[model samples]
Target: MNLETDLGGIKLADPVVMASGTFGYGFGYEGLIGPGDVGAIITKATTREPWAGNPPPRIAETPCGMLNAIGLENPGVEVFLSEYLPRLRKSGAVVIVNIAGRTFEEYVELASMIGTAKGVRGIELNISCPNVDMGGMQLGTSPDMVYKIVDSVKQVTHLPVMPKLSPNVTDIVEIAKAAESAGADAISMINTVQGMAVDIETKRPILGNVFGGLSGPAIKPIALRMVYQVYQAVDVPILGGGGIMSAKDAIEFLLVGAKAVSVGTGTFINPRLAMEIKAGIEDYMARHGHTGLHEIIGAAIL
Candidate 1:
């Protein structure tokens, strides 16, 4: 079966993608899965300047998910292009850099700088990072702000630009529409839902940042509903993801209308999950009498 798919201007050999932050520049999983193993690898969230990240206790585990306030930690874009990108290129992974910024100008600058950098297949604008004190979810919540940022960035980057939307908004579909109106090549749905965990004994919050992006299976349903809603509303390709722990979860997203899916926190439990999911998707296609992934992409939508 042909598992090939496309995310805007970038094409994929399959629908499995190593979600940003979880894959860590693709080199982190070199021993477990090769660059050609899955469709793509979205690097850790990069910033205009290096971030120290949130303090101790930045990660806390909940019932069926993980809460993180890593705070976009990275060696600024200059270091990324000079150091990380070359190593990622050498690893042969199809690189899609995930970028975040503290200001509107920062967003435009990072897109321009990274889009022109060699070895990058596309860019995923992380306008929905909720762990930080500024920019991230702030610039993402409003349709007007979403439009302005995307439209401005579109002017500078030649590569396909996809704005990853935050799930914290009242109406995520409106935000997705704003992005498409601004000429977004595609839309990446449901960046971690805003949530927090607490320490019962200490009577305090568990995360160092007090609040963090909640990921994993607990948010999967919310992610699915958002992707389904956006799919019905937008014309651009959707990279559907959130809480995908197995092949079953990935397939569910495709049924709802995601052209491709990104596997995140699930990788922490199984570094080889992407490959496993890819195989499972193929098995599903065969049993379902589907010859191509497109045949199953949005087959369940009604």
Candidate 2:
């Protein structure tokens, strides 16, 4: 079966992508996955300036998943260009640079910067960050904000602009529609559900941030539902992901109209998770006699 897929204009060797922040710019997985092991590697979130991330106790184990408020920690886009992106290209991995910024201008700046880089296949805008200029509202929570950010970034770069949608909203479909209207090349759905965990011992929050994004098996159903809804509403390709721990989970996302799947928390348990997910997808296709992803993508929607 043909697993090759196109996310925006970026062609992926397979449908499985190494989600951002899970691989840390693809350097940690050189020993685990060789060249072309996965479709694409989304680098950790890059900002205009280096971020120290949240305070300690940023990650905590939950019932069937995990909670994390890493706060988009990274060494800044300058370092990524001088170091990480080059090494990722040499490793033969298709790279999608995920970028975040403090203000609207910062987002555009990062887009222009990465667009000039050598091997970046596409750009995933991290809109889940607080809009400090807008009174700390998440840029993704407001449909207008989503449209504004995507529309502005699209003007600065020729690279594919994909806004990663946040789940912490009243209506995710509206947010996605706004992105599409703003000329987003593609859409990345369900950027972790808002959640928190408290310690009965200290009678305080387990994470220093008090709240974190939830991931793992616990959110897969919610992710799938949201992806299905957004797929029906938008015409652009969808990169669906959240708590996908196995091939079946990834397949579920495909059936619901996700053109591709991004594996994040699952990778933390197994560094080579993308390769295994790819192999499992190939196996499923052969067993089911499906010729290509088109047969599986959105097949269950009807």
TM-scores, all models, native as reference:
0.97, 0.98
What candidate 2 gets wrong by more than 4 Å, as runs, is none
Per-residue lDDT tens digits for candidate 2, residues 126-177, read 9999999999989999999999999999999999989999988889899999
Q: Which tens-of-lDDT digit does each residue in 1-302 have in candidate 1? A: 78989999889998899899988877755578888898998989999998888887889898999899988889899999999999889877788989988777888999999988889999999987432445245779989988998999999999999999989899999999999999999999879888898899999998888999999999999999998899999999999999999999999999999999999999999999999999999999899899998888777889
Model 1 residue 75 lDDT score? 89
Listed per candidate, the RMSD to the true structure in angstroms reads: 1.7, 0.9
What's the lDDT for residue 169 in model 1?
Answer: 93
lDDT (CA) per prediction: 0.90, 0.91
Top lDDT model: 2
